[model samples]
Target: MAFESLASRLQSAFDKLRGRGKIDEQAVNEAMREVRLALLEADVNFKVVKDFVARVKERAIGQEVLKSLTPGQMVIKVVNEELTELMGGNVAKIAVAAKPPTVVMMVGLQGAGKTTTTGKLAKYLQKQNRKPLLVAGDIYRPAAIKQLQVLGEQVKAPVFTLGDQVSPVEIARQAIEHAKENHLDYVLIDTAGRLHIDEALMDELKQVREVAKPDEILLVVDAMTGQDAVNVAESFNQQLELTGVILTKLDGDTRGGAALSVKAVTGQPIKFAGMGEKLDSLEPFHPDRMASRILGMGDVLSLIEKAQEAVDTEKAKEMEKQMRQGEFTFDMFLDSMQQMRKLGPLEDILGMMPGMNKMKDLKVDEKQLGRVEAIVTSMTLKERANPDLLNASRRKRIAAGSGTSVQEVNRFIKQFEEMKKMMKQFSGMADKMQKKSKKKGFGLPFMGKSAGNLPLKERGPGFPFNFKPPFK
Candidate 1:
């Protein structure tokens, strides 16, 4: 939901263009005007917006695009490409040192979530099989070093501290030696931040940079601060010659001005983004995927990556077999819900699917999933495995245990049975299709050999139950 308002406004502008049979330059100009206002309202830097709209207009008015069969879509394509280019065209990877112990200096103003992002970066490195040592270099702020130490402990990375007695420059220099001695692959120096940009802070950061000779100097900025975040990045880049930026609180930045403006202003790519407060919420910034999301095209690649990371493959295969056999049950339903929860919030997950944004009335209440899980959990093991055992008395007991009315329990059961029947129909159709494919001496493209070979299970739940649709 970072660019919720901006995306909605932009999509609205595009919608009007799409409705036209053929667009003239005047119509294109009109749409661009709307786009300009939308971008400005989103808090994008005014000059950036002017240049962006000008570029889009120049291309959109070209004969090649205006004469295209789908001129409207052509215009949108141009906008998407330009937007992606503005955001850095591609993912910016973290720098690696030629030698071991890559030193990264994290700098920013106070209250920008710099310390927390340092810990998140350490966790990201650990996932890449690198041993990262976190240095507690923020000695000025109250408990800044302690905060970094807590984060290091949470990520299981060793924190090197000089007890706030030594100068940050010396601490950073010694921390590198410590990392070298321990054979750590990366050394993250959490430098102190001030309430605002000041000469004293810049001088101290400069000294630390001189000693550490950091491979990367990343400026962390809060996305919710709008253009102030961009200004901070510009100031830091001027003094530190920052290699990249880390945008935190991006998930909560509805207007997303900083994310849209920072790279353009600072001439640095956003290397990472903090999507949530969790230590694992940090992700490599991908501009192309972000543009796709802003245009309501959905980020299928990121969604697939998240699924591959969060969902167990073997378990998914086993669940697939159960679906093919029409053997899904309450236990399977509970398990599937738990797996889905690991992928993040339901609304965010749904937003990643193509065309989901167009479903204006679609609502995904995460609490509903939790409630369903509670109902399933209240059931006895035998009841969970065998739906037929959920008689009236048992339904009442489950309803009571789950803090719901018996009528709600009955409704859930009815929906579950309907879902099972639908799965059975799908299973039979799949079998017939497979047989036909074998007879034709060719495999179905969508149903690969791995999926087609999954044998049926005698007893299990049907495919995970589809929640009641919230579509109006």
Candidate 2:
């Protein structure tokens, strides 16, 4: 939802062009005008917005024929491409040293989430099967070292600390030696930062950098700070010659000025984005996927990646088999809910879906999923496996246990049955389609989700028990 307002505004601008069968230069200019205003309103840098609009206008006016696409669509395509380019065109990866112990210096103003971002980066490296050593070099802030230590323990990584007495320069120099001795592949130095940039802060960072000889110096900036974030990045880059940026609080930044302007202003790519507070929420920045999301085109690859990470593959397959055979039960439904929960918030999931532009704004019933889970959990194992055994009294008991009225339990039971029947019908349809096309297996792509009649983007996974996400 970072670019929610900007996306809506841009989409509205393009709607005019989309309505026209053929677009003229005047129409393209009009759309660009709206786009410029939208970007400016989003707090995007005035110069960046000016440059972006000029590029889009030049291309739209000189539009070439793209087969199977209307003139309006072509203009949109141009804008998407330009937007991608503006945000660094490709994903910039974290630098890896040729030898072990790739040194990374995390630097930014205080309160920019620099220390937390360092811990997240360590977790990310660990996920890649690399041993990362976290260096607690921020001795200035009270409890900064302890905070890093706690994060290290949470991630199961080792933390190198020298207490507050030693200089950060010495800490960095010694941390590298520790990593080398321990055979750790990456060393992340969480350097100290001031509330604002000062000569003293830069001098300390410079000294630390000289000692560490870091492969990457990442500038962590809070995206919600808008223009101030870009200005901070500019200041850091001028001194440290930062290799990349980590945009934190991006999930809360509706304006998205920092994300759009940081790289453009500082000549550094945004390597990672802090999507949430969770340790695993730091995502490698993907410019193309972001542009697609901003254009109301869902990021299917990211969605699939989330599914792959959250859902158990074997369990998903077994669940699909059961659903196809009409053996769907309360247990399976519970498992499906658990799997979906692992994928994170319904709003975020819906946003990643390709055609869910309208659905993203739907009030996410967070408690609805929890309510279903509670009801199912309150059921006996036998009752879960065989929901048919639930008579009126049993339903009443379940309602009481789950703290719901009997009517709610009855409604859930009825909806679960409907979902099972729907899954069976979908299985039959998928089989016929599979045979007709013979394209690789088209089984349920996710747990408890079927290939429904709705377009892939609009189709919410089938959780047909009270959670009415948009579906055909």
Candidate 3:
């Protein structure tokens, strides 16, 4: 939710235009004025905001938009396109060297999360089937080498270190040789950072860069710093000639000025973004998708990618089969919840779905999931498989075990029964639709021919508890 405030403001401005049947110059000017204020308030650089608004206004007031059948939508499209261009127009991929062991030197100021980002980047490269060797090149900070070693162990990547006694340049030089000897495909040098920019820090980083001959020097900046993040990137790029940027703490950056302005100011594309503190939360930056999200259009591509990464395809197919046959059990429900948790927070997942931005007041209580899990876990295996065994006495026992009232337990059971009925109705409806599609010699919309070919199983007993879907 990096751009939550800005998105809300922008959407409000657009809503005014959307309400009008025909847009006039005055209306466009008014909307642009609101947009300007929004950007400025979001802490975007004044020059960048001025230039962006100017470009957006020039195109929006053109005959192609003002004379269009749906002028409001046309103006919105202009803003979206310009916003995409304001950030890097295309995705900036990580640099790959012609030779083995692509060297990536991570550079940033202290407290910018540079070391953590190096670990995250190593994890990302590992997922791409590259064996990465992490170099503990930061010797100044207290326990920096130990920190990298801990992270390296967490990611299962080997850490190359020469202790704090050796010079960082020598450590980096030797680490490259170690990577080559080990047949590692990438060498990530976690360089030292200063509290602020200074000549000594720049000189040290330059020396390390010269020794490592890094194919990419990524400047990791904390997105929560707003415009200061952009300034940091600018200063680093001026001295080290940074190849790209990695904006960290983006999930907590509600203003999003850093993400929107860094590329423009430093002339370096954002190669990756740190979505969360988790090691696996680093994701390749996609400008178009980001623009879509800012405009409340929902990032479906990112959502699908998240789903593809988090959900097991084989298990999903099996789950689908069970749902169609009305055999979804408490065990399956627990498994599904665990799988969903892998995709990140429930609120964030819901935000990725189309039209969720309109429901601004929708609060997804994550603690409710834990409570349900506790309730289910309190039940015996036999009780889970056979809900009819849960009489009043059993219900009271479960309530006591789960630290809930008997009335709450009864409500949950009733909800589960209702869910089973709904699932059966949906299964029957899907069967009918598939049969009709077969007769028509085509597949159903969204769902293809695969929907018709699923092997059905015999229905199983329903668990008697009502649980709301994870996303409200």
- Order the candidates by TM-score, highest first: 3, 1, 2
lDDT of 2 by residue, 290-406 (tens): 999888898999988889888899997797677656577888888877888788777788888875764544656777767778899999999998878999999999999999889
lDDT: which is higher, 1 or 2? 1
Q: What are the per-residue Cα lDDT tens digits for candidate 1 across 259-286?
A: 8899899899999999998898899999
List candidate 2 stretches off by more than 4 Å: 63-69, 423-467, 470-472
lDDT of 3 at 393: 97
Model 2 alpha-carbon miss at residue 342, Å: 1.3
Order the candidates by lDDT, highest first. 1, 3, 2
Model 3 earns a TM-score of 0.94
Clashes of each: 7, 0, 6
Q: Write the per-residue lDDT of candidate 3 for residues 1-472, one digit (tens) a residue.
A: 6688888888899999986779989999999999999999889989999999999999999999989989999999999998898889999999889999899999999999999999999999999999999999899999999999999999999999999999999999999999898899999999999999999999999999888899999999999999999999999999999999999998877788998899889989999999998999999999998888888898999988998999888987797777767575677777777888889987777777766766778767787777777777889998888777899999999999998889878887777777767677767765776677667654432246444343343222222224565454
RMSD of 2: 3.5
The TM-score obtained by model 1 is 0.93
